[model samples]
Target: MLLLEGTFPFVAGGVSSWVNQIIRGFPEVRFGAIFLGSRPEDYGDMRYALPDNLVHLEATYLYEPQDNPPVMPVHAAPETMPMVECVHKLFETDMKHPDCAELFAGLMDEAGPDGKVSHEVFLYSPESWEFIKKSYRSRCTDPSFVDYFWTVRHMHTPFWRLREVAVRCPQARIYHAVSTGYAGILGVLLKHRNKRPFILSEHGIYVKERKIDLYQAQWLKDNRSVFERDPSRVSYFRQLWIRFFEHLGYVTYQAADDIVALYEANRQRQLLDGAPMERTSNIPNGIDIQRFAPLRAQRSALPPPVLCLIGRVVPIKDIKTFIRAMRTVTNHLPEAEAWIAGPEDESPEYANECRELAHQLGLGDKVKFLGFQKLTELLPKVGLVVLSSISEALPLVILEGYAAGVPTLSTDVGSCRQLVFGLPGEDEAIGASGQVVRIADPEALGQAALALLTNPQAWQHASEAAVKRVEKYYSQDMMFERYGALYEKNFKWQA
Candidate 1:
């Protein structure tokens, strides 16, 4: 079973593409996926066709309005109060307690239908109300009790929904979560309920990404007045949300049997985020070289002055940075054009903003928004593949570009540095496949692109290095073999 949050069929590119590849790669294994999304309206039609091996696909929206049972007078059981207190303490300490695994297990049980503090009890009980009030008075720095009350309630509303999902989810010998947050928590619950091996493959650290979202989120209210607020410190509510995700990650880490990261640096991050070091390992993303190898022949002898960023035009990808870089790229190479080849419906506002920015910069015909083009068709025509993302986890596009004998220009984020420059020893000796620039630096990005596109020798060198690196290290067969071994090991344990 795959516990997927906002990825797979509903979304495309990045981790979703990798998930699709994994499912298709293992034609023999029967797979079930539980897709969790915020709301039905946020997504459109399925992004990828369902594979034959995918036996089941269940989707649940976390933020949909709930039809709760009518409110009734109730009190928490005496035993439940201790567990409740432990939960509060866990949140307070950011889930650093020695017995956090046991606490998390107990908390899951208490949320169960037969437990003393079930969803009904939590919503309608006087005990829950009193506890909220007590915590507000003791811990909350924000003046509004009303805001505090609603935030706490809203933050926890998903637990019941997840519990319900877990109870009804189809049985699988092993459970795997693509990312943490709600999906990770569900993985924990399913593991506790079924006693199955639970695996976590973190494409990027979910909590860190959530922290970025919370910091920029306009919906989360900051009740403090400008005079009362400290610009240096994060708002209490924002901090509260961050801690909430942190706790979720901690619990998931505690429950996972094997935690996989895309690279060594991310694996280390898993340890720092409370994952058991012994259980964590690295599994870099891989792609089909055979699929893209033929595209090399289709490329021009002289590389085109076209730069393409193949990803969703979302804020995280920093589409604006790519546009700004194009402004500089066009100044030197008058014929140069920037192609953003991904779906824009995911964030229409941001997409429109990027278009407007291009217009403002007078890059009228130089910039193109080629929405969701197939890489096979797109790669052969492009000169350079660019990644201006603020955050990424060993992006598959780079590997895909490499496989197509196209070099990359990416920001020094995630494993971009490792992918571009190569790992130490023989990997390092393969030579730099492309240039890595500072994140959000358009000037550097443009200069790097010009350096390669204008010089055939340099472009050819980078392209050769790219093809060599991907063929040697990142291949679908290599990735499949490793994952197949893991699946077999877990299946044997289950038997």
Candidate 2:
């Protein structure tokens, strides 16, 4: 079973593409998937056609409104109060307490039928209320107890929703979660319930990304007055949310039999974040070289002065940074044009803002929003592939570009630097495939593009390096072989 959160059928991005590739790559294995999303309205039609081997697919929305049970004063069982106190202490210790796994298992047990710490008990039990109040009195610095109350309530509501999903999910010999968040927690629950092997493949560090989201979230209440607030300190509510996610991530780490990261740095991060060293490994993303290799012949001998950033139009992608870089690119090469070839439906506001910024910079027709385009058709015509994301894993686009004989210019984020310059040994000997600039630096981004596009010798060297690196290292067959071995090992254990 594959536990997915906000990726796959509903969304179209690198992770979704990877999921599609994995399902299609394994025709013999019968697969089941559970997709968790925020709400029905947030997604459109299915982004990818469901594969035949995917025998079962289920979707649940976490934020969907349900009729509330009647509010009644209830008292928690005496045994549950101790468990609740331990839960709070678990968070206090940053979920590194020796008893964390045991504590989580106990909590999961109590979430069962007529159990003391079930959802209803959490909602209306007087012991639960007193525990919340006691924690607020001791830890909350913010003035509004009401805000704290609602925030705590809102934060935990999803746990029950996920629990329900876990209860009904189809059984699989092994469970695979693409990232650690709600889906990871569901993986934890299912692992405990079924006593099955659960594996995690983290494309981006979930806790770190959630921290970024919580830090920027404007809707989280900060009741402190300007004089009382410290500009440098994060708001109490934001910190609360961060800790909550950290606790969730830590539990997920403990539950997973094997933790997979896209690269070594992230694997180390998994260790720091509580994944056992023995259980963690690295599995970089890969693409089909054969699919894109033919496009190399279609490219013009004189590369076009076109730069393309192919991904979702989300804030994390930093579309504005790409737009600002185009302003610089056009100034250097008058005929240069920037093509943003991805779906904008993910964040229409951000997309609109990017378009407005381009207009304000007088880019006019030099900047184009091509929505979504076929990479086979798009790559052959483009001179350079650009990635201006603030965060990423091993982006497949770079490898795809390399296979099509185009070099990439990307920010120094995730494994982009490694992908561009190669790894330490033979990978490094392949030579620098492209350029890597500091994140959010438009001037550096544009200048780097100019350096590659204007010089044919330099561009050819980068292109050759790109093709060699991807062909040798990041091909789909290599990725499939590794994953197939993993699945086979678990399947034998199941037998």
Candidate 3:
């Protein structure tokens, strides 16, 4: 049996999709999912239906305060005493301190040969809290140490509870973490305790994605504590939160037996952060080609030269860039229509900004903001699909566009070039499906899209090439085979 923690049965994110792929890939292994959440409301219907291979499902919420606090020794063993000192240092210093790196490496070196990791590292250490309070007062001039201390205390209190929960879980041979977050850390802890192998797979870089969210998230600002000194800098609370995420990332990298990433960029980051190069692997995300195959058969009733953009309306998606491109595209092809097929009101402020840009550009109805609709129903209507996202990692939308026989014009990010042009005949020519433009460049995006819409013969060549490329390199079956091998090899973890 394998214990799968955190992402699978809980959150509806890229990590959750990876969790589903793994479970669905291996049916023989009995997998138990330990879902961790902070609040009852956050635990929804788990939109990704649990697969039959899932033998056990258990959930723990961090928001519920523990009924009984575990006791910690005023002093620990000699071997463990330095860990206490390390914890104090960790809680006191900001992330990126070279000392933090040395201390974590030293702590890992101190783990017992039996792999019995002491819980003292995560549990409340009086020495650590005292240092934290003292450092909090002196260093955190903006937010009073009193406020920062409580914030740190609240964010980390869950790790202690997670430790207790892991100890109670049914013994499993392998531990797989969907991503390196709190739940991933629990998997690390469990593997150390049981001496089992731990495999971590990440679809998107969690800490990086979380950092993006944290920077834009309004909730942190609403509750920011008053700092007595310089208030000019960004909120101290946000800084503390980012540091915590950095710590989690570093810890996850240090402990994993193997680490997986969706792209080369993310892999490099993991290695740079602390993961050994040998332990890291890149496995691009997979899509069910069969699902889109049938959809491709149904052609659009609309006329040719239709350009569509399919993605969330988030700022990162750069919907504004797409709208800007639409303004220039209309100059050559008056009959051509560009459809912005996604949620229009993701961020009311951002949405308003997009609409205002369109109005200023004088494109009254040239770019239509259609609300969210099923891609299966909408994708066929479009001939040329555009992805203007500034940041991405093997977007599933592009794959869907390919499978639907719709050529794409995407920003040069993640695996776009590899997806369009098959890697030099390790396989034959898997035709170039679309053009890759520099991100955030409206004119280049417009020109590339114009080429596809204007030339039918060129479009045909690209579409055929796209189908071959997907069949050769981006096939879901190929992905399943690779992941299946990885899971099978580590199925029987040694404790």
Question: Any residue pairs clashing in model 3, and if so which?
Answer: 142-227, 431-465
At residue 227, what lDDT does model 3 achieve? 41
List ranges where model 1 is wrong by over 4 Å.
Answer: none
Tell me which residue pairs clash in candidate 2. none
Candidate 2 lowest-lDDT run of ten: 93-102
TM-score of 2: 0.98
Q: Write the per-residue lDDT of candidate 1 for residues 65-170, one digit (tens) a residue.
A: 8787687777789877778888778767657676676677667677876788788788888888888999999988899999999999889888888988998998
Best by lDDT: 1
Off by over 4 Å in 2: none
Prediction-by-prediction clash tally: 0, 0, 2
Q: How far does residue 386 in candidate 2 sit from its true spot (Å)?
A: 0.2
Candidates in order: C-alpha RMSD to true structure:
1.3, 1.2, 5.7
lDDT value for candidate 3?
A: 0.71
Model 2, C-alpha of 148: deviation from truth (Å): 0.4
Cα lDDT of model 2 by residue, 91-168, tens digit: 686477766865786687677547887788888988889888998999999999999998888888887788888889
On a 0 to 100 scale, what is the lDDT of residue 277 in model 3? 89
The TM-scores, one per candidate, come to: 0.98, 0.98, 0.77
